[model samples]
Each structure stands twice: as structure tokens, then as C-alpha cells.
Target: MVSSISLSIDSDLDKVSLLARAVRALCEDLLGPDDQDAVELSLVEAINNVIKHGYHGERGKDVQVAVGLQADQVVIEVIDHAPPMPAQVLDKAPEDTFAFDEADLADIPEGGMGLALIRMNMDEVEYHSGDSENRLRMVKRIAPRSQ
Candidate 1:
């Protein structure tokens, strides 16, 4: 089975929650509640990164989020027109899961965990930069709903 929905929003942080809610709703019947939360969180983090880093928090910029259910997977693509991320950032995969050194509170960096969070939640994460735009694609496997 296959189904998809796309939503467009200005690069404003406030709008992200609304879009996330819509996405969570879309996944409700197809995915379990916990998976639904993962989808929402991943999408939120991806969109937030685009708005803050890609658009430099500038409002009115174009951002599109598309969620699709194909077979036993959920595919999400976050598209934007801002500059693409640096190659180093895009190439680095989560080799070792994120661990916190609770030993020292000051040791942890402030922010910069969006990509990690997205990667941890989604099964597959990829980014493509085109001449006119950049796209970040994320996919998560889901159990097929019983007929």
C-alpha cells in the first residue's frame, strides 16, 4: 500500500509544530504510536535545522515536507532552497550512538544535535543538493498494517 502527503511552510520555527502534528496524524493509522512519535520528532528536527542553518532563521523562505508510506516504510523528504550543508556534515554517519558524559555538565556542547537525532530516529537518512535547491530524505521501516 502507498499513500503520501506534502506540506509547505515558510521558514518559521513557529510553524514547525503544526506541520509535525499533521504528520503525526498522517502516520496514526499506518504506524504505531511510538513510531508516530519518532516520525514527528525526526521531521521537526529536520525542519528546524533547515530553518535555523539553511535559511539563517530568516522568515518567508520556502520549505516543503513530504511524508509517504510505501510498502513497509515511511519516506520523508525535507526540501529547501537555501544553501546546502557542508560536505563534512552530510558525509558523517552516526558511527557510535550519541552518549552523554554526565560526569561533567560543561563538557557537552550547546546545540548541534539535530542531525544526530534525525539519524537515530530514521532508518535511512540522505541529502541531495541540486543547482536550484537542496533536499534531505529520511526513511523509517514500519510494520505493515493488517488487512
Candidate 2:
């Protein structure tokens, strides 16, 4: 069985909290505690990317967020019309995320960690865009429910 929820919000950062809360309330019963947090954070990163990289933090763009549960996997999709991700970001493989040695950790900057963090939390992440809509999706698999 599959259950899902869909909502659209402006690109304003302020509405991100409302979006996250709606997604969480819809997903809470389908995901375990850890998985719920993973989905929430991953979705936030994806949406923020669309706002930051795509729309350049503009507030007028419409962002569509859809979250669903399919068997043991949770699915999240973020759609926007801002712009496709930059070529540099598209070229990075998940394994290419910044690696910090104990000493290098102190120099790690903020902001750029969004994509890496989303990849860390979700089992699968994908992006697609054309002239109008850019789509980002993340999936996380959950342990089987104890019967």
C-alpha cells in the first residue's frame, strides 16, 4: 500500500518550516524514528537547494513537495522552476563529498554541506530539470515492520 501527501509553497525560506511539518506529519506513521528524521532533513536540504541555487533565494517561485511511503521505502520529491542545479554540483558523485580528517574538521565551512548531508541521510538521491521545472527526489529504505 502507498500513502502520500502533496503541497505547494512559495520559495520563501520562512515557509520551509511549515512544509517540513506537513511532510513529517504525513510520514510519521510510515517511517521509524530515525528514518523520519532522515526524511525530514533530506527534504529540507533539497528544498533549500532549489531556493538557494535555483531561485537565488527569491520568494515568488513555486515549490512543489510530495512525500510518500511505498512498502519499506519512503520517497520525497521537490519540484521547482527556479533553475537546474549548476554543472559543478551535478558532476559530483555521492562519494565525492568533502572528507575532513580530524585536523581538517576545524576548517570545514558551513552552507555547502547541504547536498552532502542529504546524500548521507537518504538511500537514493536524484535530480532532473528542463526549461521550467527542476525536480529532486530522495528515497530511504526502512527495516521491515515486526509482525
Question: Estimated TM-score per prediction?
Answer: 0.90, 0.87
> Model 2, range 1-147, lDDT digits (tens) per residue?
788878999999999988988888777777888888888888888888888878889899899988777887888889888756787876666565665464776766555678888988999888888878788888888787899
Query: In order, how many clashes per candidate?
Result: 0, 0
Candidate 2 residue pairs in backbone clash: none
Query: Which candidate leads in lDDT?
Result: 1
lDDT tens per residue, model 1, 30-117: 7898788888999999999999999999999999988897778889999999988988776655543345575788866565578888
Q: Against the unseen true structure, what C-alpha lDDT does each candidate score?
A: 0.86, 0.82
Error of 1 at 66 (Å): 1.3
Off by over 4 Å in 1: 95-100, 144-147
The 10 consecutive residues of candidate 2 with the worst lDDT sum are 93-102
What global local distance difference test value does model 1 have?
0.86
**lDDT value, residue 66 of candidate 2:** 81
Q: Model 2 — TM-score against the truth?
A: 0.87
